[model samples]
Target chain A: MDFELSEEQRLLKDSVDRLIAKEYRFERRLDFLRRSEGWSRQTWQGFAEMGLLALPFAEEHGGFGSGGVETMLVMEAFGRGLVVEPYLSTVILAGGTIRHSGASGRMAETVERIIAGEHLMALAHNEKGGPRHSLEPQTRAKRSGACWTLTGSKIAVLHGATADELVVSATTDTGSALFLVPAEAEGISVSPQKGYDGVPLAEVTLEGVSVQTEFVLCEPGMGEKVLAHVIAEANAALCAEAVGIMGDVFDTTCEYLLTRTQFGVPIGSFQALQHQAADMLIELELSRSMAILAALSIDSEPPVRERNVSAAKAQIGRSGRLIGQRAIQLHGAIGITEEYKVGHSFKRLTAIDAMFGNADWHIDAIVEAGGLYTA
Target chain B: MDLNFSVEDVAFREEVRTFLASSLPDYLCAKMIKRLHLTKDETVHWQRILNARGWATPSWPVDCGGQSWSPSQRYIFQEEMALAHAPETQPFNVNMIGPILAKFGTDEQKAKFLRSTANLDIWWCQGFSEPGAGSDLASLKTSAVRDGNHYLINGQKIWTTQAQNADWMFALVRTDSSGRKQEGISFLLIDMTTHGITVRPIETIDGGHDANEVFFDDVRVPTANLIGEEGKGWTYAKHLLGNERSGIARIGLSKERLKQLRSLEHELSASGQLDERETVGLKRKLAEVEVQLRALELTQLRVVSADAHGANAGAAASILKIKGTELQQRMTELVLELAGPEGLALAVDDHTDGSGGWQNPAAQFYFTMRKVSIFGGSNEIQKNIIAKTMLGL
Candidate 1:
């Protein structure tokens, strides 16, 4: 029944907050974006040093045995600072797939590399017109004695251009499978995309790319199960991140209302604006509750956890738009600039909503399961 | 009451279409039709061809080499040029500085720069927006100090479009500090090759390099370069903005893009990219923008006709600025929607598979067109202008 963070979880949150204060200042975030990789390697290394990179992995895998709640703590802080590192792709999603997949030799070594910030991986599942964001990926994987070959196109893989490895999902003869393919493997092509929020995104294509048998993270039967769990974890992380963004946007807009003056008085004095600001606050609080729900329910039974995360993601998508736009409308011209914080927050919210699935898509998922309560 | 183009205006439209088909280069036409970027050389080359035919500066005064065309004729000319996929006439030369010189410049200044500007022999860029003075341009700190026969200019200007390729820059510099912030500004022209001047290209959000930040470290300019009276720069700046809003609506460009989007939608739908449900949603959104544009066109025509009757079109100009940009932006957003997630891939030329090349620029144009709402008196400012000037609030 207790909602208070554990002492260790409180320490984790504090560490993330400190790192953000030190590294993710708005100007420094812009600096990272200007770099070739569109993220800060030094900050990623710092995460490795702080043991934040290994937060969600088992201690046996050279990690801290943390779970979704710990990841939530890190993501919320990262969101407030608009951190552009691909932590969601590299750590929460791809790293989770590996940690839960029970790999023995090379795969465990890959997890170690990831914990050390020496390797970055992304899950490539979204296809152009694939069914339901590729829970059952259509990418064809064929085995030939000692090796497997994959062929498909992934439309939007976050940080796809910078990933050293990609956890690609493919369909085999019996069922779907997950393979850890080197990003620079033969017949692999990546075209870089400009993310709406300055996150590195790309269109990745594979044409008969050969993968060794040892690189298989999950066999045919386990692939779809692992992928669904990975996506649910990602959805939970994104919701927490969105809650942080909405809270920041609401706080800044209130500050702006107090400080920004027009017509010889602070604009916050007007009752019309006061009501709008209050509505934004309401949306923010509701989204926060949903994010917390997702974080706490991450390890529950399958249907409960999946339904909760989808509901949280949908709430974020709806609420983020209201809060982001309210911030912009209240701040006027300065809010939409590239240099400003509020506009970038809005962009990130937009990018979050677009990823995995948008609000309507998830709402449809909930309804297709005969609504949230039924699930 | 008559909304149709006159018989002569229709003939002029046909004449413009014929001339564009004959004169517009094939490569440039392809670039314009495909919405691809045109090189600075290609732009200047096209302007020179227009200049050779005495059609480069149609809106200028007849005494200053203008065609003395009616307002309808000019509209037809611009619309026809857009429809034919010709490269746009460089606005800095014709719409901006050329008309200013005709109105207020000294006879010698006109003789020195007018013909050269018209022929694109001297590419011009605006240097009015300083880093500290975007929407509130009167707060600019760029200094122009008189030293005998020369004025030493020193300060920075940002968002200066085409500064790298420009041969000259017309700028607003602070010449005095004793009076109101808006009163002490002076319009001055500085040659781009002047010593102690540096142009740094600023990459915009859309990954375009059309804007720059120019730094002046004690650059010297002859007093002859000053436009109009000293401390009257703000007045000229306002006048320049009025002219700037002339094509801000860019109706013809939007119409062409909408036409292109229609075809793209059909192709994607035929390829099973868009299902019936998605197609219905997209079609409805497209129809909404088309409806808004049609209404804007009527209002624009009313403004044109009202101008013919000597009524001021200031209120309608603000309306056009707001609604026109909204429709343009809405269309780009729909293209991004049609592109779905794949639109984020902007590297169109390199290894495009499973989708048309049109998908790449969907995100590019959506991110890039955001400037239309922010720049040249943001849509918010336009709303305030509408409220204060039109509504008497």
Candidate 2:
């Protein structure tokens, strides 16, 4: 019935907006991207100081308990700023798995370290040639007397080189399980690279890396459930981020149309471009609604939650492509340039569409999940 | 933010469902469900049923014999009615002119038209679009010059739906040839039986005489029929258009069509007539459209919730109009595609009652739905409004 944000949610949004507006300028982002780590340590600390790293963790685990809507607000602000930090990789993906599967002792301690900004984590669930968003990993975990050995490679390990530890999903005889392996663990290798959007990524290879049995993040056969949960949350965050990017790109294009003129009057006065801009607005608004729906249902039962997340992801992919492509088309030559913010937003949106699952992938998943036939 | 209805709203929905189940005659529901055109008598009977229950004018102010329901209540009523296959209460009277009169009419005008409108005693038709003024309504050349206690109206109105059955017509005519095109217009109510008035049928692509071209040659209309001040017809028309766009989404009607589509798909599969590849393609198309419709429905809820809280919903309403009408058109196309070879039979006589299984009427329905996107302010005009009001272009 009510769609208004709570007062606290509004305050969280304003604070993030203020921080991004102050520090995350386009030129500043470029400088940070060129650095050795490809992001700002100072900004990461600022996020930790702002309690964003702790927002989604339970209070019993040294954090302030928040939900998907809060994460949506922060990610939306991130989208507006085009922030290149590892919040999605380290916080939501890795940290969320730890919290969901890590019931006590050392795993909980690692979460506290994450909250305190003393440790960063990355998730290595995606393997080479694996199906999109498949939880049954090809990576194998072999058990010994008091330790486990992992042998496999993970592709597109987001923030893999920068993280202190990685939560890797590996299959065993019974089912799949998650293990917390140190980034520099013996027999582990990290090959860092830049993604299409210029954020840091790496391909992580495990050559018989050994880990203590206590490093098992969750019980056997629970990896898929935990991974699905975290991925749904990630999808919700990405949906919000896409909305933010589309909003900015749309606004920038509209402004360009008004000020950049060719034939006597502003080009925006042309009916063709005006209608295109209106279409962008429609896509953006619909994406916004879907994002809200996804965020609100993130904590529901598995069927409901997965259905909503897939729906949101599918919509975001389609709308993101539409808005991004139209934005570049409307901006003419400047839209494809590296110097312009609109092009960068387009790149990020494109990357987000490919991430988790693209539109076609989610659509198939939705149909298989019975989302279509459900009333 | 919560999206669930309040307890009272939920109960109201149940009440509406119950009322519709018991009161809406099965024959009328059958006609609507089959996409068959309802005769004027059928439409009036349904309207009177709603009127007798005091649920006819849900959007008007309470003092004007309206139910004074909240936006959510109105939305629920609409959704329930559409799902129940109940006939739409003929928006020309209940939704269009009734609100205009309630908002801007003199006390005398209100007393004369409001009750009759709610009771379906008078069937109203709109006369805004002319030959050259479809999307650009301001360019309409229809003029009404002043005579002794009357206006000598002389012009033509095209695409006036149901004019053949109309008892009265609310029209916009140029009262002065001065200043801006929008500044000289006046809104006038005319009796269909007036002298010099002609309602000639315009056969549509759907093979129905549902709309007409109304010609006025020195049609003497009393000046008392004017709703508001002279030269202010555009403003009043804008108000009515806004109301028109709000309900243009037609989510409920689309839902019913979707239900029928599912049944047809089932029938095809059952009879071994379904092509697997084509069926798969149709399923994907149906799923995509359904997903978009669901999003549109939520977007509508957002607008309704905003309206309930007294937020400006003009831009939101335009978004609904664009998406709603597009989905409606898409649904019709899907239904036609599902009919396969049978959809080519468009003649009314070719259709046997309850025997053709949607194919006989599917093509006709598809042709009729093309008008939805064109009317109620063309989707292109809606985009222009959104650009100006929402995008600040």
Candidate 3:
């Protein structure tokens, strides 16, 4: 089996890499992050123009029709550049879920807008006390003829503070279902929350928030499939992002060690310090492989998808924490300072880790599906 | 871009599996599967068998008794061997010195050493490391004073793995003390049976005697034994190190360990009432490690595959060593954890006969892997290499 990217894939990666080098400079992102929003709208539009925001959805939905591996490559580049767009929340999780659930017409129109960078959607799914991807929803949806009123709050609505609309999960009389509710709907309130990576998130309160029957994003009883797809894609993207962040983490740590000196020589010259950096490199590389595998498994049928995603999340979660913690530890006291980019990168890695499921969470998921041997 | 193996490679893998099953002695395989150190005779016995079949040096050039397999085929063979618990051919001979002589040794050196080296007639130990010169190997103080037609060697070498059983050692000695540390050094091949030579086994923390401290008190060696030109030894030694780093990741062995960890977790987590959730959680973590191990193996395949096709100096090997060792330590820790109170067993001797079951070897194995990240050029060095070489750090 070959592991090298195809020539076309390599060219695409090069193009993306060159584009990020020109446009998404770290200084620009740092400036944007320190602002109230913690993200740049222009950069978001640029990504849309690049066709990145549409890479995962179907062609019919105005996307590039690229699968998970391509998505992984782009997200990894995004992670390495520390791109602070709502690609994960708006494009991947929420928009991907709607596309996967076969939502069309106006919903399809919104998806197309997202593809064109005109509008964005955030997924408001997780509630307090609920583990990631948990199907048992605490929020309720009451059916009133052609209208449905959503009650209860959704915490951790990724990019919720910025999205024009939200695809939320709630329990109905039948089962769990996905609803497209307007972000500015009456009785709906959103308070911006700070993600560890300085990205904007929100704790959304849907007090009797209402949606029309046509706004349902998933087949009434098939929310399970939509939720599964969203969680899988979300975790896969997070894994790719961690792989990217660790790439940055390894570079930052290596540069520090090379320049930082102790006992009259660069610390990089010391075997003790050098060996630690090498260990980080190992984790980063292996994590990249797992991330690719998870991204590849995104469209696979159950069992394989569960196993691959679980494995990727678990491995990336473990390595992400190690790389993040060691990146700081090796960088010494300066690493923890807000002034250092390594610290910020470490925070982002930690957040990606705790997002979908921690190492332990995914590990359990793998076993619950079947042993790796069986899978 | 295809991820599926060619039919020939697949068939080659099956051939390796069959050969390992029928050819390797059951006892030797058992030792490997359990990560037990092979007895001297057991190692030699297996190597001879492999030599006879011309599979002893799977990656060596065919004219020198190497297998005629492609790069992917050789990788598959190595992976299958490791997974089947077949004893790894002694690295000092196959991986380190043999390749050095083949690539850089003089024609005379090749005629004298190649065949016996491949056939296991001469057991070799590396002498690059010294007490004060582990990572900064160029700083070594071991000197070889030139005389008429011979050189008198002086000073000591430490951490020489398997020197006690070695017939010869390919050593790095100071030949020109006036020049730069790296430039002044030379590679010397010394017979371990020479006069004024002393070999003392240094027991590592894992209770293995494979490592040693070797001393030379004016040991005399013919100039003919020097590899390449004087002071060019540094260049040859670097070549040797480059070869060493090529396979230091050890993916095949880690894959076997992961499988063992999974089975152990299942056996432990299923019995009686523990916090079922935590038990399940721990098992899941073990599975995750296995998954990562598989990914690492795939990366290894890519690296070794490219290496076969002449893509050397890639940063992927650095990545492999880092993640492979970490995962190894994690697997050991998980096994020990599952062993619970049984993990604290100080009875290292219990596994000597392979009766430790799963519990006995778990502790000692965990302790042994603590050195993995430190030895064979520590993981930290690998990262710096990747940074400079691959990422342009």
Q: How far is candidate 1 from the true structure (C-alpha RMSD, Å)?
A: 22.8
lDDT of 2 by residue, B1-393 (tens): 887888999999999999999999998888788888888888899999999998888788889988868888888899999999999898899888999999999999999999999988999999999999988889889999999899999999999999999999999999987789999999999999999999999998888888899999999999999989999999999887666333557888888888887777767867878878776776677668767877787788888877778787757778888899899999898888888897786655632254455787888989999998888878898899988975465
- Candidate 1: where is the Cα deviation over 4 Å? A1-375, B244-246, B348-356, B391-393
True contacts reproduced, candidate 1: 0.00
lDDT of 1 by residue, B226-323 (tens): 99999999998788665633455677777777787777777888899999888666665554455345445555555565555566665566667776
**TM-score, model 3 to reference:** 0.86
Clash list (residue pairs), candidate 1: none
DockQ, all candidates in order: 0.01, 0.63, 0.38
> lDDT tens digits, residues B1-393, model 3?
445688988898898889888998988877777666668788889999988888888667777667777767767777788888888888889988888888777789889998888878889999989999987888999999999999999999998988999999999999998978899999899999999999998987776677899999989999999888899887887665555333556777777777776666566667753468767677657666677777777677667656766776467766777777888898888878877887676665633577666676777788888988988777766667765673344
Best-performing candidate as measured by lDDT: 2
TM-score of chain A of each: 0.97, 0.98, 0.96
After superposition, candidate 2 runs with Cα above 4 Å error = B244-246, B347-355, B390-393
lDDT of 2 by residue, A231-347 (tens): 999999999988888988888888998899888888898889999999998998889999998999899998888878888888889999999999999999989889899988999
Better of 1 and 2 by DockQ: 2
Interface RMSD of each: 23.5, 1.7, 3.2
